[model samples]
Target: MALASAMAAIAIDTLLPAFEQMRPAFGLSADSTQLSLTLTLFFAGMAVGTLFYGPLADAIGRKPLLFTSLGIYAGAAVVGALAPSLEVLLASRFVWGFAAAGPRTLTQAIVRDRFSGTAMARAMTLIQTVFFLGPILAPILGKGLVALGSWRYTLLFGAVSAGVLALWSLRLPETLAEENRRPLSFATTLAGFRSVIANRTTLGYTLAVTFGFGALFSFLASSELIFVDVYGRPSWFVPYFSTMSAIAAGVSIANNQMLRRVEARPLALSAGVAFTATSGALLAVTAASGGLPRIGVWILLFSLANASMIGFAPVAISLALEPMGALAGTAAAVVGFCSTGLGALLAAITDRAIAGDVMPIGVSYFVYGVLALACQLWARRASKPAHI
Candidate 1:
């Protein structure tokens, strides 16, 4: 599951350093924001593709779908590497994102099959800690690759890595039992979605994760601009970006440790509070400074804010999936769809607004943070007894 999750992150995060090179290679203006579209489009594809893969996983079992998704993802990566134009590359990337939905969505289903409650949350955190390692190291690896060759090599690297991971996945046994499998049908899929929607707690946490993901996506989309354009530290971009992701990785690891003593709900709510507070402070500093703050302050507070939110994912996902034993794939699909789809939307909006100033990104962080907190509170209230 960790490697599966890392596939998507590696595809996007690794290519971040390649953004500068991509524009020129594709005959784009140096200042074009279109390069960022590659990321958003990849996400858009995931949102669509999960709808198919999730239901198929539930119907056919995980192993076959895993092979299918990874094969397509690998092929798409090769196409992206050989793409002769920006249009062709982006189209290939969208397909790459689409095919990736298999691993991205089904991994959660596989985990939910084995565990529930706090243990499930713990598993997710531990997996995510490993998952976060991809982002921490991807840039350094990507930067090295770019230094040695070009951005196309980075895409080719992803192709090769994904193929290897696909083969590695074959060794694992199927988690979804034959008796538990749902027949593939429109009515069955709809019924599963309806069940997810009727559960207020599931719906609430799903939205919380959605908005939370939006904030993170916004930060990621603008990060290159933040470190490279705003701070004028191109070489420092990977180091600082890795530091930010490292904080999230550390928080997930800490959350895994704390899960032995803590429940997921309160911890998630508390994380939301901390995340909102961090973003609020970031907004204040950015407003006072006109736009960019001192690089040191910005990086510290931004990383901290992002870290707080990162801890919430495992908790929220576990809570949402607790009541979804029979429909883990479909449930995960809805959650992934909302989070990735809405997140990509937020990133696109933030990308357009940032222009050259990063104040918009700061504002976006605050806005999404507050929205996530509100959803978290509502979820808590909705989950509680009236007597309490």
Candidate 2:
């Protein structure tokens, strides 16, 4: 499950270090923000693709859907590697993103089938912590491949990786039983969507997760530009980005530990407060310093802020899905759609808002953090108290 989820992270973060190299090769003008679309489009594809897979998985089975989706991803990766034009590359990437959503979202339904309450939250964080290694390692790997030959080699590597995972998924057993399987139909899928949307608390939590993902997507879309272009330290991009991912993974583990004794609500609230303060401070400092902060200052503040925000995901996801076990596939789809789709939109907006400075992106993180906290609070108010 962790490996499957990591596919998206690897696809995006791995290519980040190669953006500058890819720009000229693909005929993009210098300093063009168009490259960021590669990452954002992938998420947009995931957002759209996830809506269909969940109900289909619930109706048919998990294994077959996994096989089909991963196969699409693998084929897309090959097409991406050989893409002759930027249009072809972006289109293939979107298809890859759409395909990758199968394993990524369906795994959540698998987890929900096997666990509940705090156990489910713990499982999620643990899987996420493992999953985060992809980000920590992908940039370095991409950098290495770029060093070896060309950015196309990095794309080829993604192809091989997805192909391997696709075959590996063949051995996994289906978690959804015959008795629990819903008939695959438009009406059944629509009913599941309505069930999730009608629940105010679940909807609020899902939106909160969406905003949190939006903030992270904005950062990912801009990180390479900020470090390489704005800061003039192309060499440090991999290390700095890797360190932030490492911090997120460590925080996930820490969150899992805290969940052993602390309730997710309080821990999540504390994280929200920390994220807002740290990110807001970073924004203010950047503004005062006349655009970008010192590299050390930016890394430290962004890492801390991201760590706080990352810890909230497991808690929020688990809480939102707890009451929707029967609707797990559709619920997970809704969550994936809102978070990835809306998040991608936010990232694209923030990317366009960049004006040769980090101010817009920095301010976005602060604003996103604040809105995320508000959504969490609303979710809390709407739901009844539970042990989680």
Candidate 1 wrong stretches, greater than 4 Å:
384-388
Question: Relative to the unseen true structure, what is the C-alpha lDDT of residue 97 in candidate 2, on a scale of 0 to 100?
Answer: 92
Q: Highest lDDT, which number?
A: 1
True lDDT of residue 180, candidate 2? 94
TM-score of 1: 0.97
Error of 2 at 105 (Å): 0.7
Residue-level lDDT tens digits of model 1 in 1-388: 8999889999988899999998889888867788888889899999988888888889999999998999899999999999999888889989998988889898999999999878888999999999989889999888888899898888988889887997898798999999999988899899988998788888999999998999898877878876677677888888887887788888999999998887888888889999999999999998999887887888778888889889888889888888788999999898888989888998788888876667987898999999998887887877742110
Clashes of each: 0, 0
Tens-place lDDT digits, model 2, residues 271-375: 888888998998988899887778788778878878887988888888888888898888999999999999899878888888767888778888888898898
TM-score of each: 0.97, 0.97
Worst 10 residues of 1 by lDDT: 379-388
Task: Note the Cα lDDT for every prediction shown.
Answer: 0.87, 0.86
